[model samples]
Target: MVKTARPRGRPPKDADPAPMEDVLQAALHSFATHGFNGVSVRTLNRELGVSHNLLHQRYGSKEGIWRTAVDWGFGQLTEKLSAADDESAPPLDRLRTFIRTFIHVSAEHPELLRLMNIEGGEPSDRLDYISERFIEPQMARFQQIWDELAKRGETKDVPQEVMYFMITSGGGAMFASRALTERLFTSRPLEPEHYAAYADQFTDLIMGALKD
Candidate 1:
């Protein structure tokens, strides 16, 4: 498949060139939609229309590219999550911030959850890599927020595991269920302004349920 060329406009001043950004995004979407076992460096190069030897030279193998793409994705998510708050707010407010931040990120990068869902279907090193490298650490931060909320009497007596899934999988499904969303809502990709509004509403809904 020939990748449709996107416009390459001039970047703003001091903008660091991320040459691999598009490649990693495409790789994530491919892995998400097609499954890890279904994709390869050869397929990536063929679809992406890059030099046949380029990905192999840079990444060494399909596994290497998969790891790098996954890392790039989670790294961006972690950065966005960290930028949402500085951890100085109240427990409840911090929880709200987390919810909003996640919702926005979900809208921006639905492929992330899709890829995880595919990998979660069966045991594999890919599953383990994402779990240990990304999911666990992020969940730890979520658990910290939950603990703080518990201390402040802001959260209910729900199991932390259930709450975690409710936010990550349940809430994210509203956005990440792209096939459904496109049919019911719009075919175009979600933009930041629209996601910001959705995040506000979604965050309020979660905070309402959590607050005593």
Candidate 2:
């Protein structure tokens, strides 16, 4: 069998991470504003005031810069989420806390969340990386909560997969729905007020479905 070419090394030893960060921030903004496929290297170069050669020399390719931006965004997000998980509350309470905090943060960081949603639709080589790095660990946390509920005979016939879907997807949809919700109602934000409503609705709906 023919050998595939391996990926290159990290940035040069003397290279500053700052310029790379600028490129990443610019790329992420473009991706979130337009989309992953909609962005071009020229567009990124214009945004960052960097030459095409600098971008390539530092990042290898546009795909490399995009991946770096996506990874950095997710890394920041995971830091906040893991911090939320570390709060000294019980499991279910902790889940709700995390959800509330997540929605609050999403409202504050729409571009970041938009980047994530956009990446979900793109042809990404980092799907497993994203999941394993962020989603799976959180899923395991939820699984522990679900296990406790099940032992108490408080759960339904629904599988843990469905429970995971309901919980996580509900939060995902809540954050994603803000744009549409903003169109219908004006003069009010979704984070504190409307987000609470959605969270309560989601919790009630999920609890009703899961509870025997």
Candidate 3:
């Protein structure tokens, strides 16, 4: 019989790791659910039922896994959020793009915010990694637009953080807390159209309030 081929670099004792993307997604969920300290590489291996050293072999440690996973999740949001950054677009139009895009993506990947919410409870190196890498950069871009609107008297002097809360806690709250929404709004359809409608409505309310 022809010899069977073995996957390269997957030593005798070490089984092949899942696709990196899938691994990161699962790791993100685990971190979101249990918090960083509550989970370990062994925990993930057990959860995946792979070789005990599989994650460690790939990630080197829990910190590495957390970084990889967090980056993977935020990378998706960052890409979609980029659609709002048309330099030729007017300031107000860009701002609307930013807000509505955020809502749509939040609806699509609530896990991104969920992971942040979990890490937000207490400050740690993990928190620093996320804040410095993802949170601060995204907020900085939005902050610049908000300042321009304030200068034009297009927006109130509402604290930037407060506006952020309005978006996250106000419009995105349903997706962020999926369990409650599923229970409360049994008839609601989670779809692209639904995301667009909510984003448009929320953006209108905020834009109107700013103009008022």
Residues 1-212, candidate 3: write the lDDT tens digits: 99999768747544455777778888988988888888888878877767888888888989899889888888888888875689677778888888888888888877777877887888788889878887789899888888888788876788888888788667777887887877888638455568889888889988888778
Ranking by lDDT: 3, 1, 2
TM-score of 1: 0.86
Q: Write one digit per residue (lDDT tens) for candidate 2, span 1-212.
A: 99998659865433433466666777777887887569888777766665556777777887787778877776776677777775466555765666555555555555665666665665566566667777788678767766765676666656767655455445555455666767777427465566556656666555555553
Clashes of each: 0, 0, 0
The whole-model C-alpha lDDT of candidate 1 against the native structure comes to: 0.81
Q: How high is the lDDT of residue 21 in model 1?
A: 85
TM-score of each: 0.86, 0.67, 0.87
- After superposition, the stretches of candidate 1 with alpha carbons farther than 4 Å from their true spots are 1-18, 186-191
